[model samples]
Target: MEESTINSSILGTKEYWENLYQQEINNYLDHSDPGEIWFGKGLTMKMVKWIKSKSSQLLPDDGDQIKILDLGCGNGHLLYSLYQQGYTDLTGLDYADKSIKLVNQMASDLGIVNNLKTYVADVLTLYKSNLIPERIKFNLIIDKGTFDAICLNPDLDLNQVKSDYLATLEAILFKGRSFFMIASCNWTKDELINMFTKSSQSFLSLYDEIETPQFSFGGSKGNNVTCLIFQRLS
Candidate 1:
């Protein structure tokens, strides 16, 4: 990990995303779609459709409804999209203060003043956060680029980061009902499947796959992103 400290994304850190939202927040107010939607709105809408079709399975009717946590939530665009689709039990967590501020502003501006909660909390240290209630467990946890950033960090500690990340997730998921939805431009489906199924430190089971768009990028024959769903087994 020390050797990876010199990489580009590591060079920017949370500061880059903060500056990005600061400059683009006003622009987002006018535009229907904005920057680095991580693959784009097309894929996001595809995810929306997938959720719409699978809501009963994902949310169930146990009377608890559905609770979702957006890890490294950035500006909360994913939560906003979910909100537009009429799913309201949402919470977003980010390490950057500015990102949380922007997410709250985005929610308030959209008149989603009460349904969404955004918190500033480090994913790597999430278990220690007092912002979230101890008894609450999420029905779904989502990640767009959080893992990519974690793996790219200059200070990355494989053992500590992986342990903390998985521990926090395990602590938050509702037994028998919670799962994780991860979308990434940094990993392939096989790679992700193996990471959870084969990794000695991981306890996730492959629940399903979210079909991703197939498109060429950098002359490749596949999409730049991969979407995967994993359920907690422990």
Candidate 2:
């Protein structure tokens, strides 16, 4: 895997994230604002609905048995929305401590603190790290713009980071039975597809995709966001 075409930016640095989340924390305390919602509030609900529909087909029997992990879960809005829809077993991970703190505060405010657990863990260092317990394996894992942020890191090799991400996914997800869904605003559909499928240790297969709104520019059509779902093969 080579570097992503996306240019490096400050958004890739942990320091940038910490400062952003710290400001969000201040705003949350002062004005009761829940902070940034990533792409938008609507996208959060859209992801929640998509997960609900897929879990029905995949789990079928007991929704509680399906454990889900949100990679780079900023402010934990997605997990919070999922909890509202009756998905209880959820875990969220973010590298910034302020991000985790804000999420914990939000969860505590809603009195659903026990429903979703959050931690401060960097995705690039997730494998073999003690941040998340080793025994826990998720049935469904999701990412909303995390990989895009990672690819923006000018310090680390994007290819190595992508590999580390996939390796982390392999470690935490149930083999052959788990699903990974990602929504990205930066990468094209084809670029994202090749990133996962063309890896040297590829074990993921395209399961399905969600249709997002499209925009036309200069007579060329493109999506504002791309949502792809993949399953780990045995």
Candidate 3:
């Protein structure tokens, strides 16, 4: 797909996702069997490990339940992994309405509906009008493919979008917390590092940068698919 097309596809305001959900719902009604697409087993296991490792380090005190917010939590697959790992306090934020529906359905199927919260709102607009409660500061926020999707759009004004994303991230994170961002992009490591450092200087401290192997399409390979774990410190 052309970059312009991909960008235009998701550039709309709230109405975009609402219409998307309606279409998905109609399609579901028309189809007899609809199968789910999963984040592959290898990828899921890697994420699970990452979550577990981070949670273990952060949650040193026993009986302290950690709150996690999965930004762009498509279908809640990562949330499901965290749920299986015994993290009960979880919330998923996704702009796609169909994704929220599918996530809720999956949660119900897995009997974890009670432990997860789903929100359908633009990431940039989440805090406007106090849409997200003040008491909801997450211990960790995980971004898998959300950043890639945002950057992949050709219609996006890159600098403006980055500024908005950074501001929103700072608003939501608690002091000394972390954001684990996994991305696959053509940008160099130094560029990404500089971007994060510049954007998060006021609210976050760069703690660790992990270079992990990530699979790419067409049997290609990429290094440092960059899992950045930034500690929120104001």
- Clash count list over all predictions: 0, 0, 1
Colliding pairs, model 3? 176-232
Across 146-173, the per-residue lDDT of candidate 3 in tens digits comes to 7666765666676666677777787787
* Model 3 RMSD in angstroms: 5.1
Identify the superior model by TM-score, candidate 1 or candidate 3. 1
Which sections of candidate 1 miss by over 4 Å? 1-8, 26-35, 215-222
Candidate 1: worst 10 consecutive residues by lDDT?
Answer: 1-10
TM-score of each: 0.86, 0.94, 0.76
Encode model 2's per-residue lDDT on 1-234: one tens digit a residue: 565577899999999999999999999999999887888877777778888787765572344468999999988888888898888888999999999999999899999988888888988789868778887888889999999898899998877888899889888887767789999999988888898887788788888888888999999999999999998896
Better of 2 and 3 by TM-score: 2
The numbered model that scores best in TM-score is 2
lDDT of 1 by residue, 1-234 (tens): 121222446523777777877766766766843456755778778877777787887774577668888898877878889998888889999888877877887787789979998788888777777778898789889988787777666656654666687778877888786688888777677777766666676768998887776887688777578888898776
TM-score of 2: 0.94
Candidate with best lDDT: 2
Estimate the TM-score for candidate 1: 0.86
Residue 217 lDDT in candidate 1:
68
**In model 3, where is the ten-residue run with the lowest total lDDT?**
1-10
Pitting candidate 1 against candidate 3, the one with the higher lDDT is 1
Please give the lDDT score at residue 37 for candidate 2: 84
